[model samples]
Target: MQTDNSYANTFATDSDAELVLPSHPAQAREPQWLAFNAELAGQLGIPESLHTTAAGLGLYSGTELPDWIQPVALGYAGHQFANFVPRLGDGRALLLTEIIAPDGERFDLQLKGSGTTPFSRGGDGKAPLGPVMREFLVSEAMHALGVPTTRALAAVVTGDWVQRDEAQPGAIITRVAKSHLRIGTAQFVAHKITQGADESLRQAFADYVIARHYPLSKDRKHPYRALLRQIIDQQAHTVALWMSLGFVHGVMNTDNMTLSGETIDYGPCAFMENYDPNAVFSAIDRAGRYAYQNQPGIALWNLARLAEAWLPLLAKSGESQQQLIEAATELVHEFPIRYEAYYDQKMAFKLGLNSVTAETQALTRDWLSLLQDHALDYTQSFRQLADTLETNVEHFEKMQSWAAWQQRWHKLLTLQGDSDAVVSARMRQHNPAVIPRNHWVEAAIKQTVASGDLTIFNELTQVLRTPYDVVPLELSRYAEPAAPEKRVTRTFCGT
Candidate 1:
């Protein structure tokens, strides 16, 4: 890896001292490399020599660190489910270092499941191999699908066991992100300010966020308000992309919500197969708070919490606190409008429309309603629709009310004056032919844990890299939805 001392502790400051604590990763008993994202490493200018050698394993697994590397555990607070917790930080992860890519993009290099920190909350900071694999695969898959997300750099076995129900093999994963700043981080600062800490802390943190993530906001008349709007726009677009791709981020807690608008935690996340809007896969979400269709609303809720955290800053120049609150509330309300626009545009593209209009929006909604009504596979339905446009095949012949919908769809394309071939090509570009199917992910993990084989895992990752492309014969199984008995109805937070 290239050295850039200037990028060290990019979020650190005297006022931010209390927000971060110096930490070191626990040494692994016998660290063994399991998976390394060579492609990502190359993109980030990480030399193959480093990753191929023991030096890479040691650095990534937290068994060792270079002198310039300053590892720290970030502190924050968050709302878990819907209840607010005043202190929830990086309990199992440390920001190892920051790397600047060849394209001049800065990224945080963090080690998850490395060891315990002050915020460990009396729990072991080790991650099981299953969640490690899940995050490594799914995060990369999300990146491949062109969604803004943190990417996995590597995974390794810690050569030590961690107890979670039964004794499970411990592992660690290296996560790369633009920054790990979250809504909880702001909440923590707000709490401090409320407790009569130096008001400068809030200003410093806000300045840092604007300078780093929302630099353009610094030029605005009301920079704090602009910052909130920009963050809302980013989150709305990101969550819309998640919904368009049938992704359900099971744990939509405030702490897991990144201010950078990147998808953070992959625990309990699953791609929706059957097109039920009420899908709930996270084992811990008994109430289905973060279900498939509830994501946009939950995202709005999280943004409200973020706005609340920024009350002091947003009110810095308002005529009255009530005025500032009202202003923030109005800004927060733009979330749904922006979310709906984004969702409509993406859904229209999936249905072979160049842009969203009233007609296109109606068509998209009707299509989703049909899918939900029939319990059809979400991803495959759109993919097969694209294929139907091209091949003129009766793939959806058994679907109820399909003939009527097809006639309407054809009429719209004919009205638009686009060739069926061109329309089909457009749809294929948006509707993915594959997703990181839950059953296959579990199967890959099962293989790795039972016999230490990575063939299935490697193959699945490859197929996910080109999700929108046509599936070749050998990789066809990856594109197929899981059989009835093999369906993975529940996903767990492997903490």
Candidate 2:
């Protein structure tokens, strides 16, 4: 497999590492089967020959690290559901190597559920089959839906079982991302500063992040502040897209928030069925802190944590400490405005508007209000809006609430001077015809675990690849919401 040992060559240390620790050797039990992502592997410049068999996959999940690969378990700190955890690192995940694509783009090739590392705390560092497959499906689905996310490269059955609640098959997912740097990574460096580490440590980590993800920052006058602004912008756009698709990330912990702006961890995440602003599906999120509507605010909060970590670095750049703090604080405060702008544009497109105005915003708000009041399916409501606009005139001449909303939408379209064809096309592009429904996901997981049948899993993956397209009527079952008895109300973390 193609590899770049740049990270190890640049950052390895004997005692006081800036970010990662030496990976503890752990064995993958009876590595039996492997599945490679041909598409993603090709994108990362992996030759077709390297990914065709179990041996190729073994290079990533195997007990022995190849000469070109140096596995390291990273260190970080995070606020979990608003509670600060001083240290939370790659407990069960390890960065194997960086892959340099033909086009010069670099990506991290990491293994989740590989085995325990020093940061594994007191728990066994292994992943069950169900969560592994969940990530494979959802991450691929998110990519297909045009959301920024960590893509899955391969999945392997380790021929072992992990006892979560009961003995379940253990598996490993090979995840690929632009980088693994997170807000918590910055927090870890900041914490080190308080523990008597010199400013050089923080600067080294920050420079590494800039080189890896934001190389352009090196050209800016205030590169550190520029990096912060760039990260904030990426996150703002990412969270807006998540909201547009009704995706609840479930856990918006600082550790899970990547500086690369990709959706990293997928544990307990779900798509909203009924349109409630406060929708949450994580089993552990009893307080609804990372609910659907709360995501933007929580993202800002996470970015604030990142800003806190970078303050010292910014101050060391010849700027007065207080000046740097005020500047960083101002940049963070721009997140809300940036998030709203992206969200407003997306909402306008969903409403089939050529332009967003005060009236359009009000109309969008009222439409959401209608959906929440009636507990309407979030995806279908917008997906069906274009159809409802035409059908209301023929079937519901009496003007029901939906029909009235349609009239207002049509008037707004007229005001914008966009033809029906133009507006309909815009709406279809923004609103998906289907999503990875919670119940369908649960059903697929149950079928795979209980019967070793991958029929449902394969079919669901295929359907979600073209989520915005109208599927065949025979496959319409995939688009439908869950039956009352089959609905999955809550989701759990893989750990």
Candidate 3:
């Protein structure tokens, strides 16, 4: 791997030393590649020779690195499941390096499940093969689905076992992201300043964040406040996309949310097969705190926490704490309105409406109610709806309420003066025929672990690459919902 690029070492050399702790990845005993994202590698201009070379495997698998490369475990604090943990950071992940693409975009190349860190917090830092595969498949699937998310670079299994419920095969996944900075990172610095650390630390950290993610904020009169507003807008857009796709993030803790606006943590996340607002798949989310419908609220709550972390920086020289709080609160309150605007626009297209209006909003509400009441598959129902529009097929004929909603949708399309074919085409563009279904993910993980068979895993990844396309006959099973007996009701963080 080439390490001499001009911008390759920017984060390592430029970020405030106080923000990151230098660390080393535990060398794997028998590192082996389980999967490599050749497409992503090509996009990054990685040499083809590096794809399967022993030296390349060592670098990505946390077994070996060039002497010049200095990995660090980032430090941050977060609210995990509404409880404020003052210090929670990258327990098993290490930032190996940063890559600046040929197009001038920068991405962090991090090795998750690498080894112990100062922030490991007494737990084993090794990740099991199951979660490694889970993140790799689901994150890549999210990218194909057009959800902003961190991409998987590679998957590797160390011929070592880590105890988690039982001894499981240890593994690592190379994650690619715009940046790994999170709201929790700011929270750490703000907390440090509150506890007698120099105020300049906060300023330095904030400036780094603005420079990396929101450079335009620097020109604003109140740059800190502008940064808060930008993060709020990003969270709104990302969460709205999640809602549109029936994805329950399962954990909306401030730490899991990225300043870059991409979905970061994939632990315990799942797609809702049945359109139930109360749907939650995380085994640990016992209270339904991060349910499918509750995601928007949780997103706003997390942003509020980020705003709280920025109070010191947001304050003017002579501003009182209360004044600063009120100012930040005002900006945080913009989240719901912004979220609704994004959600409505996406939903409008999903229903074959070219634009959102009061009429379309009302129609959407009823359509959701129908789905929830009938427990319709969230993804398939939309694809089926498009078919109904084109063929007058009455896919939901068995339900009495279906006819009324169908008639209303058809009439609205007619009044709006868009042809059925045109509207249906638009709907297909917005609604995907496939998602990373929990059962499929589980089966793939199980098969790979039990027998080292990647046939199912590889095929599933290929089908997900074109989720918006009509399902071909050979891939029909991938587009279908899980069978009742095979349904996976709960997902785990798999730390």
> lDDT per prediction?
0.88, 0.84, 0.86
Residue-by-residue lDDT tens digits, candidate 3, 1-495: 343322224333534434577789998999988999999988877777668789779888878786756788888898888888878878999987777677767788889999999889997888999999989999999999998999998999998998989988999999999888898888887777777776777777778778878999999999999998998898899999999999989888989999989998899999999899999899999999998989998888988888887777788788888888888899999999999999999999999887888989999999999888888898999888888865655548887688888888888888889887898899899999999899999999999899999988998989988999987899789889988999999988878
lDDT of 2 by residue, 469-488 (tens): 99778678989988778889
Off by over 4 Å in 3: 1-18, 317-320
Q: TM-score: which candidate is best?
A: 1
Compute the lDDT of residue 97 as modeled in candidate 3. 71
TM-score of each: 0.97, 0.95, 0.96
Better candidate number, 2 or 3, judged by TM-score: 3
The candidate with the higher lDDT, 1 or 2, is 1
Q: Would you list the clashing residue pairs of candidate 2?
A: none
Report residue 42 deviation for candidate 1 (angstroms): 1.5
Best by lDDT: 1
lDDT of 1: 0.88
What TM-score would you give candidate 1 relative to the actual structure?
0.97
Candidate 3: C-alpha lDDT:
0.86
The root-mean-square deviation over C-alpha atoms between each candidate and the true structure, in angstroms, is 1.7, 2.1, 2.1
Instruction: Supply every candidate's count of residue pairs whose N, Cα or C atoms clash at under 3 angstroms.
Output: 0, 0, 0
